[model samples]
Target chain A: MSAQDEGRPIQSSTPDGAAAIGRHAIRTEALSKDFTLHLQGGLRIPVLRDVDLAVAPGECVALAGPSGAGKSTLMRCLYGNYGAGSGHVWVRHDGRDVDITNADAREVRAVRRDTLGYVSQFLRVIPRVPTQQIVAEPLMARGVPREDAMAHAAALLSRLNLPATLHGLPPATFSGGEQQRVNLARGFAPGYPVLLLDEPTASLDAANRDVVVALIAEAKRAGTAIIGIFHDTEVRDRVADRLYEVAPLQDAA
Target chain B: MSALLTAEGLHLHFGKVAALDDVALEIHPGEVVAIVGESGSGKTTLLRVLAGMMAPQAGQVLYAGEDVHAMGEAARRRLMRSDWGFVHQNPRDGLRLRVSAGGNVGERLMAAGARHYGDIRAEATEWLKRVEIDPARIDDMPLQFSGGMQQRLQIARTLVTRPKLVFMDEPTGGLDVSVQARLLDLIRALVAELGLAVLIVTHDIAAARLLAHRMLVMRRGQVVEQGLTDRVLDDPQHPYTQLLVSSVLAA
Candidate 1:
């Protein structure tokens, strides 16, 4: 699916001049990204091209595509994890649209703190940190009092069906499914304006998957604009409002 | 908000090394701004220059619209004892070891022209209680106190004058982890309660996150990144900031 296949016409206007981000929580304009694999004989891998994606408040837009179709690449670009080779990734922050592609470090940091959030597939476990603290850190970083943050963390953990006994222990030795729950709890507790979840329930059981679906529904109801990559079609159908297909590039070096 | 203290085009050099390189900052009234970086990043040097202790080869520090470096020695000393307070990393550097805790707190009051002995002693006793030290220990010398107690006492002495701006250099540097935690909590509470404008320098990212509303991440004597505290710690943009955040033992 090219940029036009999504029913949005190609925009030739300056990507930085103005943005329609007041209504939409996030949007990209003619955004293109490529990676130059230096070790592989300077091979240029074009992952995404002329991508125009947008999500409105209280909506959940899921990225749909086959494996290696650049879905995750697009997700990363939206979150400012990957630099856009050309065009702008405009994110609404502090009541203005900021292009993360050209934004300075400070601007990007400000956008991420209150406006955007991302939950990677795997938990980046810090050695010796309790599971509850791991989940509570994002809240604490946002200036929430420690006690309140911990209480909120504990509440989210329990909602995910994580046993109370395991809350005090680190997730380093936990099963993949358990760690995924921890990651989900951490990402969801802060209640960001926009969120990105990549394969959020890949390792979860059917029961836990249902809990995740409910969480997504609640977030959407609370006015959170979410962009997620859900390989599980059933889970995707339950939560997604629409699908944005990312087609693979034909010119691969 | 108007800034309480502003430094512009700060530059300093030690032999061949640039300890402070064209650094600039603004701290508003009742706001906490922290300078954070690894050792030898020039955060401490920047603090000293801002406090009027060390004159930068270039740049000017303005406090309430007056140039800090342009003031005479005597006027600067007078300013330091009254409107400004500095908390050194070592308590001994900030306190008089021979003086009793009460006397140390009272000395600043006396310097500020509170000559009545009764009022000075009463205020000192109140401050001891505020810092969580027993009021009865007011007569004890700083040497008799533990490390954490000494640090608390140092804080009490500095804050006794109700300085409009306070400069802290690693206030929890040498303490145990538990002690550091307590000190941080106390600092946070006191800073909020008094609405004191603070410029704290620390290598501890967690401490900075807990106390400062804004932070400057320095590297090689330059401000590589700076922004809201949560933003810098969460999604660090500069490569040096990312390395610094990753180096910490995450809690």
Candidate 2:
């Protein structure tokens, strides 16, 4: 059946059979985004084409593709950092459904704070914010108490094998792998049910890549659904239960 | 074989950390040598020292039978610009991201004061095609290409100048399996075609097996094992080398 003919707003209360299995996470249908590059004299280019994706509770889905294949763009669309031109992204929350694509800016911010988590390819940690404070940012945004959030962040950092000495220092000075662990800790800080990661292991070595994979498995055991874009197939093999490829963005006239 | 580059009793320190300790290496013309080490094992530091980017506290570096450290700055710079090509761990560091692919490939020639635009473009196109990138995209920015393509472009950039010695640091660090295979094949063919001597640093034993004529296994900034690739990788004697070989073999 056509998505429009269903007489619904392209929103699914739960992904197919996901709730029947005692969990519901993220669902999307015909989800697509088109970017307009405003070059000199106002020329526009359509970047992403129609793409469909879904993730179940505790499942890790990997997006694999070459550069300019719209993987990053799709991640931005799912995180609501960029508006989609057409489609719906539905997230199940406390026995109800919310269409993230249709939400207002404030509502989207709330969803991001309480229900969704995101990690981008290039981590932009705020300078001078201690590692604990950086990880606690998401929890603080959710109105959690500062002391409790800091404790939680500390525990996560230790579990991820970050040195205790790094707790009070800004993540900007940390190594690439350490910074990525901090980024993961921040994404998981608020107990969000759905997490999105973009190239989390791109700069890591073999040993550190193994560590990150173990963390993803830990997140899975906690029942957080994950969608990640990975450049390394070894990482994809270790973390993803399923894989999808993003086709190259079509050229515009 | 006559030695082209030699390091004797090299020592490097970063603060209190000993990155390389009494490391010795020798590279001969038309030979490919692979340095295999885990992270923090100082393979990169050794590369930098050989390339004259880093100074060692207690060592002598001989290039073409001359003491490289005793050379003046101008001579060293001349040697680097005219006789060496170094590829970094990340291709972006080796390339100018804002420039066109053709411009990147032709940069070394331009640096050596080649002013003919037609010759530069022709050489750039030839190298790009040799590296298997579409010539039509020669004008595209480095950022517009894929990671594998970018690495290939960087290889073209370095090799277009036809340097006698090339240094590559984990050239396949972040590439996919298929891309890595293709790139390794390209590098092998090009190195053979140019009769170029290579000093490659990599963590992947499989890559060393496929590319290097000789392999050196390092740990804690020391060469624990060194021999022909088959001899070293297949019959490693040191515990650390054994562990590394098993890990790669099992992987």
lDDT of candidate 1 at residue B104, scale 0 to 100 = 97
Question: What would the per-residue lDDT of candidate 2 be over residues A21-79, giving only the tens digit for each residue?
Answer: 23558776678765433222334445566677878889999987778888887787777
DockQ (Cα-based) per candidate? 0.06, 0.01
TM-score of chain A of 1: 0.90
Quantify all predictions' global Cα lDDT against the true fold. 0.85, 0.78
Interface RMSD of each: 12.2, 28.7
Clash pairs detected, candidate 2: none
Per-residue CA lDDT of model 1 for A1-253, tens digit only, reads 1211211121222244563556899999899987654344556778888999889988999998789989988888787766677888888887778777667544565577788989999786435568998898778767899999999999999999998999999898999999999999999999999999999999999999999999999999999999999999999999999999888788332
Sorted into a CAPRI-style docking class, model 1 comes out as incorrect
Which sections of candidate 2 miss by over 4 Å? Answer: A1-253, B249-251
